[model samples]
Target: MTLDAALPALSSLLGDRLCRSKSELDHHGQSESHFPPTPPEAVAYPETTEEVAALVKICANHGVPVIGWGAGTSLEGHALAVQGGIVVDFARMDRIIAVNAEDMDVRVQPGITREALNEALRATGLFFPVDPGANASIGGMASTRASGTTAVRYGTMRDNVMGLEVVLADGRVIRTGTRARKSSSGYDLTGLFVGAEGTLGLITELTLKLRGQPSAISAAVCAFGEMDRAVAAVIETIQSGVPMARIEFVDAATARAVNAYSGADFPEKPHLLVEFHGSEIGVGEDAEIFRAIAEDNGAEGFEWARQTEDRTRLWKMRHEAYRAILASRPGARAIVTDVCVPISALAQAVSETQADIEASPVEAPILGHVGDGNFHAILLIDPDDTAEVHAAETLSARMAQRALRLGGTVTGEHGIGMGKLGYMAAEHGEGWQVMGSIKAALDPGNIMNPGKLVPPNNGAVG
Candidate 1:
């Protein structure tokens, strides 16, 4: 039951694959964002499914917490080891087991990053489209159920991840889902494990649905007169049923930050960056419709980039938005607020949130995936300043409440980790208790990535 005892056994089983050095602990402990650091007792590099199973079995026998770490790019602290245990770093597990080009599905290990997968598939003229900006591991993305800009068209991890191989808390290996697209099978365990965030099980492999690379892809940018007008443009575009590949929003502050940081000369105004993917004529038709919608909402400077290099530059700035916001204000940390609201409520939600940021002490910059009615306000704060932290946290809590009120969710792409634990009760209500019940049923000993997603309160510890 003690970590000291578990470490030696894991070391023997994994040989040099198991790491206990202080440097490994420190690296695995840190995350991309502002959450406080929490180092695991040890880090294990499991190269195969069997290795992961053995590691999990050992940890379960001793009742030691087991943290599954991927690229460590999660924003909600899903990869942290707050309970202190073995960190299973999935780096060595990065392998593509199979690419069923005929079926348009690929099977890959948990540690394979998105960029790597896409690179491997480049010659196949097919791509996996669940992009969370960061080059996160496929396993980590499945655990968090991540969605990003491309999710509007291609769907999120929850949809693209057709099947999974999960190592449950009790060291049971199970496969959920099948190679076929749909099924009426029992329990739907694949769906259950996708967004569980490692609280219930560790995902070892994923069978992801792939899309044929569009023959004609066009990226465009349009600036709106105001934030509400910009949101209205997005709503109108989606309502028109335009199959946009991606539709992302960048507010004035966020645009300004990127413009300064990335040396792009875009106007400091609310802009909608979008991509259209399809056949030559199909993409052109959607582009025409999208441009008209934006113009109706008073959008200005409507421009499209057809060249691949130009499109890359446009998305590069967008992907670095979080870092740009941090760099905009030197020495300032950020509390990134994520909220997904109903489309009808988006304009109002964003307008009021903009006002709230102006009124509050925290400096917030707004951006989002507007096609999904999910947006974020990156609130800059001084982690050392208690007052600033409280102010930012208070504003984030308000946004969560507002999202629930609008019949959305506390997190749209980022899974509920420790940061959003406070809003679980508000978002799920009695359903929150239901989640805890499921958690207890699967991980009764509370040994799998404790203190995240499910808070382990309610019926979890009777």
Candidate 2:
């Protein structure tokens, strides 16, 4: 029942694949966000599904917790070993099993990153559309049910992931869903596991739906005099059904940060960075319509990037926004808050949040996939300043409350890891209990990523 007791069997099972090095443990323990390091006792690398199953079985038999580790890009401490356990690092299991170009889906091992998958599909004239901007592993993206800018059009991981191969807590292997587009055969186990955050099982493989590369792509940047006007443009564009491929919003503060960091001279004003993907004529019409909507909402400095390199540079800035925001304040740590409200409530949410940030003691930059009513505020605070941390926390709590009040989710993309556990009860109410019941039934030993998502059980295993 002890981690030390389980080490011998794991060591024998994995040979050199079992790692107890301090550097490895430290690497697996930390997160992209501000969660303190809680490294696992050991890390295991399994190159095959059978190896993964066997590794899980040994850990289960010894009553040792097993946590899955992907690209270590999770902001909510989703992959960290909160309690001492063995982290099943999937770095070695990265292989693209098959590419069904006709069916428009690809089979890949858990460790394949979204970027890598897209790179592999480049020659096939198709690509995976779920871009979380982190180069995150496919399994990690599926586990968190991630969405990003492109989600406004191509959909999130929940819609793009067609099936999964999972290894349960007890080391039993099972497959959910199939290559078929839709299913009505039985319970949707795939959906259940997508956002489970590895509490129930570890995803070993994923069959993800793909989209054909668009014939034409056009991106633009439009600045607004006011934050409300920028949000108004987003709402109007969405309501107008312009079929935007990506529509992201960043506040004046964020725009300045990105401008300084990326060497792009953008006006210090609220801006919407948007793109359209379709036939050339269709994209032209969409761009025209979106321009009208933007201008109607007081948008100025409308800049278009129709060339490939220009569009890439535009998105590169958007993706590097977190780093840019961090650079704005040296030595300041961030408490990133994600909240998604109804599309109709988008303007009010952003306006109220901006007002709150203005009154707060910290500098919090706002940005997100506004087309989907999802946004994030990077609440910056000096790590040594207690008052600053408290103020940032208060602002984050307010944002979560506001999202719930507006009939939205506390997290639109980042899944509930240890960070947002407090809001689950309020967000889901009694339904949170049902989630616990499901976790208990499937993971009776509670070895799979304990201390996350579901209600806590005081570290009890089995």
Q: Pick the candidate with the highest lDDT.
A: 2
RMSD, each candidate, Å?
1.2, 1.1
> What TM-score, computed on C-alpha atoms, does each candidate reach?
0.98, 0.99
Runs of candidate 2 with Cα error greater than 4 angstroms are 458-462
Weakest ten-residue segment in model 2 by summed lDDT: 453-462
Question: What TM-score, to 2 decimals, does candidate 2 have?
Answer: 0.99
Worst 10 residues of 1 by lDDT: 453-462
Could you tell me which residue pairs clash in candidate 1?
none
Where model 1 places Cα greater than 4 Å from the true spot, the runs are: 457-462
lDDT of 1 by residue, 370-456 (tens): 898889999899999999999998899888888898899989988888888989988888888888889999988888888898756
**lDDT of candidate model 1 versus the reference:** 0.89
Q: CA lDDT of each candidate? A: 0.89, 0.92
Query: Which pairs of residues collide in candidate 2?
Result: none
Please report how far candidate 2 places residue 169 from its true position, in Å.
0.5
